[model samples]
Target: MAAALDIKGLKVSYGNIQALRGVDLTVEEGEIVTLIGANGAGKSTLMNTVAGLVRTREGAIHHYEEDITGMDTRELVKRGIILAPEGRQIFPDLSVKDNLLMGGYLRSDKENDETMKTVFELFPILEERQNQMGLTLSGGEQQMLAIGRALMAGPKLLLLDEPSLGLAPIIVSNLFKLIKRIRDMGVTILLVEQNARIALKTADRAYVLESGRIVAADRADVLLKSDLIEKSYLGKS
Candidate 1:
């Protein structure tokens, strides 16, 4: 089967400062593919490029075999390509439920209802505090809301940027479980995370970005056992 998402020979430039150099990546249907690297590794830049928030300077990105290299973010969302940006880009004043509804803005069908139900099942706390203001939730709850909102779109490919940021270790662990559950339900994911250990352990496959280039790519477990990983992100034992 074709990949849910495919990025080939991707090169990105931010006014002469190249962010991605000949990057090639794929997310198989229902797989969790994590991009792990240190700061300035261009992981976030890769996500933005895939989402069409940043146009590609080279290479092509395809979703379900359709080229979406330079499409609008709204159009991509309509096609079930959703990105839950880093930092939980939720409206502080809006209620959590309302913010989730915003994610379904393009949907007029009962599909979103099913999606919301799944999201609630994944994070019951979100359902419990449905009417709470987004700003009122703790960092973990806010991150849950962010994932819930993205789930609202019922995306075939979910692009997540640092879902575990600023949360307790326990929360991060539980959150990764929910992510796996989503994958089990047949949603493909392309995650960019700063937490190397958790990401490499959870994802089936992994890529390591460094200074705007892909320095490593392999099965997650392979990366976990690599000396390069210990030298770069994980300290040596």
Candidate 2:
């Protein structure tokens, strides 16, 4: 089977500062692949580049065997490449339902009911607060709203950036559980996470990035036990 997402020698830059330097990785279908790194390690940059929010300076991005390098973000969305960005970038003034509706903007109302139903089932609170302004929700609720909104797009490949950021430990645990649930539902995931421990724990495969390049790649379980990973990211020797 082909990879759900494949990136080859992917490089990106902002002015003269390079964000990604020949990064290569792949996410197979029906897998949760995590990219773990420090703040400036270029994980988020790679996500945005894949999502078409950032233009690449070199290399290629392929989704399901088709070359999609430099595809427009809107075009990428139409192709089932959906991104729930690092920050919960929901429409603050819109009602929760409206925000979700925006995610399905490419679809007609008649086609989105089932997707909405799935989103609601995954997040019952979304149904309870359907009419509430997005800004009124707490942090965890906002994060749920963000993921629900992405689900509304009927994504084949989901790119989640920092889904655990800023939440409490318990909330983060619950959030990762939901992420695994999402994968079980058949949407392939490419996750970029700063919380390396949970990221490693939840992913099927993991990549460690450093200074804009991939330094290590392995099965999540194996990577979790490595002395380098334990000391560097897991805070133990």
Candidate 3:
């Protein structure tokens, strides 16, 4: 089977600064692949490039077998490549339902109502506060809104950037569980997370990025047990 997403020799830069350097990564269908790195390590840059929010300096990006390099965000979303960006970029003024509806703006399908129901099922709190303004929700709720909004697009491959950034520990735990549930629902995931320990525990495969390059790639469990990983990212001595 073809991989859900394939990227080869990907290079990205911003004027004088290089963000990603010859990055090669793939996310197979129905699997959770996590990318872990410190701040400014090009993790977000990779995500943006795949989502067509950032232009690449060189290399190729493909979804399934089709070349999607430089494709616009709307085109990518229509093709089931949806991004729930970092910082939970939900529209503050819109109601929760409206925010979700915005995610499906490109769809003319009749099943949008059904998709909204599915998102409500996945996040019961969203159902309870469907009429509430996006800015009124708590941090965790806003994050849920972000992911639910992405699901509203009927994603085949979900690109999640830092889903656990500022939540309490218990909330983060629950969020990872929900992420696993999402994977079980058959959506392939490409995650970029700063919380390496939890990310490795939740993901099936992992990649380590440092200074804009991939330094290690392995099964998530393997990386979790690695001394180097433990020492550097996991905060273990």
Candidate 4:
């Protein structure tokens, strides 16, 4: 089968700085493929570029054999490409329900309602706080809302950027479990995370990025046992 997402020789630059240098990766269907690296690894840049939020200066992005490089974000959304984004970019002023509804804005009222019900089932707290303002939610709740909202778009391939960034360790654990559940729902995932240990634990395969280039790519379990990975990312010897 063709890969769910594929990038070849992808390059992105910000003025004089190159964020991605000939990075190549592939996410097979129904797999959670994670990109893990340190602060300047360009993990977020790669996700944004894939989502069409940033322009690529070179290479191509293909989704299930479709060339979608440089496509507009709106069109990408319509094509079942959704990015939950970093920072849980929820609308501060909108109600939890409304914020989720915004995610399905491209769909009809009936479709949105059905998807909203599914999201509610996935995150019952969202239903409990349906009328509450987004700004009033806790950080973990906000993160759940962000993922729930992205599900509202009915994504075929989900792009999650730093989902475990600011949460407590316990919350991070639960979030990784939720991520696996999301993948089991038949949506392929391409995750970008700075939490290397957890990221490896959650993914089927992993890629290590350094200075915007791919340095290692292997099965997550194999990478987890690597001495070099332990010293650099896992903080273990």
State model 2's lDDT.
0.93
Every model's TM-score: 0.96, 0.98, 0.98, 0.98
**lDDT tens per residue, model 4, 74-173:** 9999999999999999999999999999899898899899989888887899999999999999999999999999999989999999998789999999
Q: Superpose all Cα atoms of candidate 4 onto the true structure and report the RMSD in Å to 1 decimal.
A: 0.9
Q: In model 1, which regions exceed 4 Å deviation?
A: none
Ranked by lDDT, the better of candidates 2 and 3 is 3
Q: Model 1 shows how many backbone clashes?
A: 0
Query: Which window of 10 residues has the lowest lDDT sum in candidate 3?
Result: 103-112
User: In model 2, which regions exceed 4 Å deviation?
Assistant: none
Cα error, candidate 2, residue 4 (Å): 0.9
Top model number, lDDT: 3
Task: Assess the local accuracy of residue 75 in candidate 4 as a C-alpha lDDT between 0 and 100.
Answer: 95
Estimate, for each residue in 1-237, the C-alpha lDDT of model 3 and write its tens digit.
778999999999999899999999999999999999999999999999999999999999989889999999989998999999999999999999999999988876576798998889889999999999999999999999999999989899999999998999999999999999999998999999999999999999999999999999999999999987998898843
Question: Which residue pairs clash within candidate 1?
Answer: none
